[model samples]
Target: MSNASTSPFPLAACAEMLWRDRPIEWRASRLKELGFGVGLWNWPEHDIGKLEATGASFTIMNGYLTGRLTDDEGADELIRTARETAQIGKRLGVQRLNLHGTGLGDRGLPVQPIQVVTGVMWLKARDTLSRIVELAEQEDVTFTLENLNLPVDHPGTPFGRAEDTLALVSSIDHPRLRLNLDLYHAQIGEGNLVELCRKSLPWIGEIQVADVPGRFEPGTGEVNWNGIARALKAMGYSGPIGMEAWASGDSEEALEAFRAAFTI
Candidate 1:
């Protein structure tokens, strides 16, 4: 649990979202200097050695390169890639490895979109996550399944809603496999943010935030992030809160706004 005097939750910001023109290592180092842990997306796009040199506390990163959650072949590929990515995650000392319902492509669209998810697909997704849990246990790492917004960000993505993710993770009920409760997506897909957090508290490994209108930092848009911060503190959630948002203007100012929102 984080100390209330310092921060209500351990804070992190996505390096990929900040300083788009700067070098990745420079962004990581700057984030560290600003007292926030760093979050990463796909590892292959950047140099691991450079990231390690920055000495940032890596909070999370994408778990697999390419795979889906609702089929045998996709599940197998997911496991294999996740195993490989775990090695990189360990190398960087990343706290949580993130997963989506399926692999994302250009502009966050699902590579293999599904119009309807069948009952068998649900069963298979559950079973597949169980296998991921086994892999996580074997590798001594934690994996988080994140919910995505279908209407705006990920159209036709099956099992992309918070309700579906909560159902799956709660069913598994394993520490190695937890929910990466992304409030940005939830706010867009379903608006009862505080209530959603209350329901997801048990299975949440971490919480991600971004303002609703522009996917920018806290206080720049519609979300009452400070109120939600208080709500999370009241709910006894002392885990990582990551800012996975773009800078509306200056990146440093954006980060400061994020810090203020969750600082309690």
Candidate 2:
């Protein structure tokens, strides 16, 4: 239930991935026992009460939008969904809400990337997020714009690069709106991890870490986590750094390696 003020590098275990052996309701408490102050989750839904009972901080949860923000109709839907979820998040002591800006146009069909007229898509996304930011401002919640790797993990996603997401956030300049710089996706979409993180530090609200290629724990792939940690510390980014990755071996062992790599 603490942030950077309590620790040099605030870290959290991803509840969605780690501790799959146990019931989801019990995962936060397990992370708390591991000396982490925060736990990451997606879509609060019915889990708010269960997570609140654990007495650990739910660092961040997905906004859970059913449609892309690439169109007016989808944007309206996202706004409605986010506003509803934000209400539950506030009651559950969740600190931040993560959002994947847009989605593939038409699921269950051939995955064609949004290649035509990128400007229109960007403008639509901007307008869509503007409304979400208003909701976040009203609810006193923080919204994090997460960048995904298009044509890799996520095909046809609009905001696949860090620059595109940052541009959208900058255009809508608000205190509550910030970046969720996911290192794994960043590496896959674009390289130069430390530089990208350092440049985006000002707008960054939260961070997610995993090695590239396999998307496993740090040291398993080519990502230089030690250098990234130093960069974050040097830039004074003391926000919760989320371990969102697959376990290379035992989940606990993966987390232990995470602790050592991040020096938490």
Candidate 3:
């Protein structure tokens, strides 16, 4: 296998979503051998010693074990767990730690669903993120808040929309805290991706992708990933772009399709 990137951007694939029959370390090692970084979900599910032995460059992983961004109790837990995860992330040389508006439960549903986000809730969420920024700065690590889709995958998740995440991230305007900017979720919750990326350019720590309607690799669904790739290149946004999707068939073929779509 060749270990060279065709795209200018640093490409990664979530190991949790690919090669389901293989061991996690095998998946990570394979991705690294194929010239891609690795992404993970919750770290506790895998063996840290084995992961370290694989020597994969971990791009991102879930930053918290359990917590929400909208309330006091949840915020406290979020901070504590994120702090602990930061240590593990540093040990693994992971680039960014990922977070959602709230902890996701079985089937990616919100553990604590919110029907309406009041003005007070918005203020609280921002304050919570500010504290997260403090933790990031102190730990010398970056944390990203990812946008989720309400209509399809994650319903009732506070700040799940790209607009909401942008508002919150831009309001904080800190380097340690940045946006994960999942285009798959943005496509489901809001359209106008190019424009959204333009608006999100300054605060993006990383970009995540999966084709819409199936959460599979780029060519398997109804997303113009090639066009988006061109647009991103034109905008001078060369950063990490991760494939957080499942394989429609063969995982290797799926990864090749993803690389092709982003290789402008």
lDDT against the true structure, each candidate: 0.94, 0.76, 0.94
Give the clash total for candidate 3.
0
Instruction: Provide the global lDDT of candidate 2 against the true structure.
Output: 0.76
Q: For candidate 3, write residues 141-169 as lDDT tens digits.
A: 99999999999999999999999999999
Judging by TM-score, tell me the better candidate of 1 and 3. 3
Cα deviation in Å at residue 3, candidate 3? 6.6
Highest lDDT scorer = 3
Per-residue C-alpha lDDT of model 1 across residues 1-264, encoded as one tens digit per residue: 222346868899999999999999999999888888999999999999999988899999999999999999999999999999999999999999999889999999999999999999999999999999999999999999999998898998889999999999999999999999999999999989999999999999999999988899999889999999999999899999999999999999998898889877
lDDT of 2 by residue, 62-140 (tens): 7654656677877877788788878878876788887775533343121335545367877888888888888887889
Off by over 4 Å in 2: 1-7, 37-41, 44-46, 103-113
Error of 3 at 32 (Å): 0.3
lDDT for model 3: 0.94
